[model samples]
Target: MIATAREVKDRVIAALNDHDTEVVMQYFARDAVYVGPVGPAEGREQIAWYFEHLLQAFPDLQITPWCKVPACDPAVSAVSEYVMTGTHLGPLLLPGGSMLEATGQRIAVRGAGLCTIENGLIVSDRDYYDQLELFSQLGLCLPEAVA
Candidate 1:
């Protein structure tokens, strides 16, 4: 049986919950791109690197789906928010050529995600989240929020 968009979303969430890079990579297309508040990451290599860094920063990450709607064929668009709270036991690169160690602080960030799947693999994702909140949680530079 072929995998549906919902199935892919579930699997991806499960993979993230497990902190398994291999599993997460399974759902993404080789050329998939991730665009989010943090920044833009293109291709599987960069995507994998980003996830790896995230896993290192928030090893115990869990994603809960707020809602999901299937889009044009083979595409499942989802609007969901996830909370990631973990210790910052690793080095985090900040703006202005600065790095900060994890303060073991807990952070919860709400996000909006749109996942596009093709041939059962995620082709692209557009993520809407707050980078300011993330930075503040990490004790990094805090930029003014958009009014």
Candidate 2:
């Protein structure tokens, strides 16, 4: 069971490196939830849309897996640590329907993901990453700079 979870976790990391819409959608359940920097996205279709936009924003995105571990229930839980490297080459849309212009900056940021699997598909996957760090790498600054 744990072995299956580990393979799923590894495949997920590999799929994230590509731009294919189907690749990103295959691991998710129909009603899966994906939590990321912006917020939680409910449903597999929503999660697929998120990845599509993300790949557009970072056309050369690559994820390097650092670690993967079985967390609980073997086939039900796994955690992954990785570094996502990419260049901002297209508009990045925000949750509230606003878009950040491409800054053409490159970022290699550390991130982690916790995934819950049911019957070999992801039911819930929460990703933890430094959004502020990503913005900083892209040279984004608020109107009022903080010291």
Candidate 3:
């Protein structure tokens, strides 16, 4: 039996909550593209690396999906709103090529993700979240701009 997009998304979410990168990778196509706040990760290897880094940064990370939009085509798409809670216990690579060392701060950031699946595997995933919210939670503030 073919797996629907919702099924694949559920499995992926379960794997993520378990902090099992291997299981998560299983649901992504070899050439899957995962686009997040930082950037796009093309291919399974890069995607796996992205997940690994996230788990490392937040070893106790937990994702709670509060809402899921019914996919018009269950076989091809899935979307959901979730809150990710975790402590910054490891280094985080910032967008401007900076590394943020662990501040031991706990954060609960609300976000959403959309995935496109094909043949039981995710081909593309786009994640949206407020980077400023996350940074502020970690005690980071942007420097003032000079006129």
Which candidate comes out best when scored by lDDT?
3
lDDT tens digits, residue span 10-55, model 3: 8998999999999999999999999999999999999999999999
Ten contiguous residues minimizing lDDT sum, candidate 1: 72-81
Off by over 4 Å in 3: none
lDDT of 2 by residue, 73-142 (tens): 6677888898999999999986477898888999999999988888888888998888888878989775
Model 2 segments more than 4 A misplaced: 1-3, 145-147
TM-score of 3: 0.97
Clashing pairs in 2: none
lDDT of 2: 0.84
RMSD of each: 3.3, 2.2, 0.9
In model 2, how large is the Cα lDDT of residue 14?
Answer: 78
Evaluate candidate 3 by giving its C-alpha RMSD to the native, one decimal: 0.9
- Report the lDDT of model 2 for residue 52: 87
> Where is model 2 poorest over a 10-residue stretch in terms of lDDT?
1-10
lDDT on C-alpha atoms for all candidate structures: 0.74, 0.84, 0.93
- Candidate 1: Cα lDDT at 85: 57
Clashing pairs in 1: 88-102
What is the descending TM-score order?
Answer: 3, 2, 1
Error of 1 at 14 (Å): 0.9
